[model samples]
Target: MKDIQSLPPGPKPHPFFGNLLEFQRDQLKFVERMQRTYGDMVTMHAGPRPFVLLFRPEYVRYLLTEHPRDFMATQSAGGDLMEVLGESLLTIEGEAHRQQRRLVQPAFHKKRVESYADYMVQYTQEMLDTWHEGEVVDIAQAMQQLTLRIVVRSLFALELLDQIDEMGRNFSQMIEHRRSLLARLLNIYVDLPFTLYGKRMSAKRRIDAFIYKLIRERKAEGQDHGDVLSMLLATQDEEHPLSEQQIRDHVITFMAAGHETTANALNWTFYLLAQNPEPREKLLQELQTVLAGRTPTLNDLPNLPYTEWVINESMRVYPPVWAMGRKSLVPFEMGGYHFPEGMTFLFSQWVIHHHPDLWQDPNTFRPERWNPENDEKVQPWSYFPFGGGPRICIGMPFAQLEAKLLLATIMQRYTPRLIPGFPVVPKPRVTLRLKHGLRMKVERTATVVKDSVTMI
Candidate 1:
C-alpha cells in the first residue's frame, strides 16, 4: 500500500475555490468522476483546503476503526444535518457522544427492537391493504408512511397518523431548505440565524413544538408507558436528567432518521426486485419456505437468511448514508500521506462499495453476492452498508430487522411490478431515494392460511 500523501493523484483543482465548484454542482457525479480518474485515493482541494478522498476498503477500515481518535467526524458537513438532528448522537463527539449513546442505546436493544417487529409487520400489512391491484402507487411514499407509522408507534406508543401529514411536510421542507444552494452559501458564515440560512428554521420550530408537547404530556401522566419515549423521559444521569431540549432533540432525530432511511432502503429493494424478477422470486420463495404465510418474528429472522442477504445487497449498491467525513484534529499518517490538522478526510461508500477492484461486476444488482456461500470469499471490509468501526450506525440492527420483516411481510401479500419506461434513478438526497417515486403495479397474491392449505 502506498503512503497517504503519495496515494493516487486526482484532478487539479482551481485555485481559491479548488474543487468546490464541481462538488457543489453534483456531489455524487463529482465523486464518481474523481473515482474513475483517480483509482482509490483522490486528492481535491475544497476552498483552498486539501482533502483526501479515500475509496479503498482497507483505508476506510483504518480511518473508521484503527485511527478514530486522530480522524474525528467533521462538524462542518454534519453541522448541516444537525439543523434537524440537533446535538443528537450523530453529531456529538468524544465524551459527550459516549454519554449520549449510553443514554439512548437501551431503547434500541435487541429485545426492544424485536418487540417492535410485530408492529412493523402489522403496519405494513395495513398499508398494503389500501393498495389497489390496478392502481399505480408511489411505493416510496407508501413505505414512508408505513415506516413512519411504525416509528411513531414504537417510539412513543402513540398514534401519530393524524399528525403525520403535518410532520412530513415540516420535515421535508426543513431538509430541502438546508440542502439548497442558498443554505450552503449562507452556511459560510457561522453566526447566521437558521432562518436566514434557509427554510428549515421554521420547520424546526414546528417539529420541536410538537415534540416538546409530547414530552410534556408524558411527564404530566408521570407514568412508565413502556415505550421508547417513556424510557427516554425516565432516563437520567447523576448530575442532571435529560433536559426537555435533549429529549426533544433525540426524539426528533430518531423520528426523522429512523423511518426515512429504512423506507428508502425498502423502496430501492422493491425497485431492484421489480427490475430483476429472479431475485424477487428467490426472496419470495425463501419467505414462503421459512415463514409459510405467517408474519416473521424475531425468532424467524435467523431462518430468513435470503431476505437478509437481499437487503444487504441493496444497501451495498445504494447505502442510505452514503458518505462519511472526518476532519483531522491532528496530523495522521496512513498510506504515507501527511494530512494537515483540521482538513476534512472523506470515505464514500458509493465509491468503495462500487469500486471495480473491490467487487465483481460492481454495478450489477446481485444479492447472491451476499449469500453465505459466496460472502465469505470476499475481503472483510469489501462491503459496508451500515458503515464500520465505533462510529458505525447504532440503529443498524434495528433498521435491518425492520427492513427484513417489512420485506417478508409485503412479499407474502403482494408482488409489485415496476412500470415500464418509468425513469428510475437514484438521487443522493438525505438518503439514496428515487428522484421520482417507484410506480409499481401491485398485484394482490392469494392469501395463504395455515392448516395444510397454501396458494400463490
Candidate 2:
C-alpha cells in the first residue's frame, strides 16, 4: 500500500475539524474550487474522516459499476437517515439491499409505472386549475404539492386525500430539520419541542403512525388496491414475509424519494426555461404541435423529443441529487492512490456536468446538446442526474414521466415568467432546492383550448 503522502492534493485541513467547516460553508463552490485547483481526484477531510472528491466520469463509472462491491452507499445527514428510512433499499447494502430491491422491483415495472399516468395528468390539471393569470406564485412549492399529491394517490392509493397536505408538511419539516448543519454535525437527539432534532423526530413519529396505520389496514383488508403498498403486502418469500415495519419502511422510502426529487427537477426545469426564452419557445412549439393544448399521455412521450431534451438539459444544469457518497468496503486503489477501508468518496453531478472537458460550453443552458446525433459522443457517467449502476435511482422512470407530463400540462396552460431581479439560488440539501424559492408570474397561453380534456 502507498504511504499517506501518496494521497491526492487538496486544501489543507484543520487539526480537529479537518475540512468540515470549509465543506459546510458552501459545498458546491468548495468542490468546484477544489476541482479547478486540484484536478480530478482530491483528498479532503470531513471531521476526522478522510474523503476523496472525484470529478472524472471514468472514476464515477469505476466506482459505481466496475467495482461496486468494493464500496457501498453512505448514509446522508449524519446517519439520521437510518432512523427515518429504516432498512429500506436506500439505507441498506449487499444482500439485504438486493433482496429489498427484488421485492420492490415489480412496483416500478414499465407497465406498472405507465398505469399511473392517468393520476399524473389528473393531478397536474387539478393544480393548474388553481392558477390565475398575472398572479405570482412560488412554483417550487407548487411543484412539491403537486408531486406529493400524485405520489400519494399513485403509490399508496390513499383515498383520504385531505391527509396528503399534512403528510407533505411533515415530510418537508423532516427534510428541513435534516438540512440543519448543526443538527447533522452534532447528531442531536434531544426530544424537546423547540429543537430541530426534536421537531424531526416528531415528524418521523407522525409519518410512521400514518404509514403503519395504512399497512395494518391493507393487511386486514387483504385486497389488491393496484398500488405499491398493495403489491408489497401481497408479495412474500417462502421463508420470510415482510414485517409491518418493513412495509412501513418501503412506503416511507417511496413517499420521500418519489415526490421530492421530481419536484426539484420540475422546479429547475421551469427556472431554466424562464431564463432561456429561445429553448423555452422551442419546447412550447413542440407542446403545441404534438400535444396541441390537450393533456399528454404515455404514448405522446415518444413524440415529444424536445420536451425530453429540455428536461435532460435542466437536470444537467441543476441535478436534484447533486452529489452522492460511497464508503469503501475494503482497501482499494483508484486513480493511482490507495484508499483504506471506510474511506468516504464523493462524486458531484454539478462538477462533472459543468466540467469544460465534458461539454463544449458546460454552463450554458443548451438543450440541443442532448440531440440524438450527439448521443454517441456523450461519455458514460458524464451526465448522471439520476446516478448510475445497480443502485441508480429506481424512481428514474417515474420521475421522468412525471416531469414531462407536468411540464407539458403547465406550459400549455400558462407561461411562467420569472420575476425580474428575484434571486434564484441552488441550495444543496437532501435535494438541490432554490434557497429563496422560485417566484414567477403566470400568464395565460394562446393555445386553442378544448372544451374538456379526458384522462386516458
Give model 1's TM-score versus the native structure: 0.91
lDDT for each residue of candidate 1 in 122-148, tens digit (9 for 90 to 100): 778788778777688888878887888
Q: Scored by Cα lDDT, where does model 1 land?
A: 0.78
Show the lowest summed lDDT stretch of 10 residues, model 2: 447-456
Give every collision pair in model 2: none
lDDT of each: 0.78, 0.85
Best by lDDT: 2
TM agreement with the true structure for every prediction: 0.91, 0.95
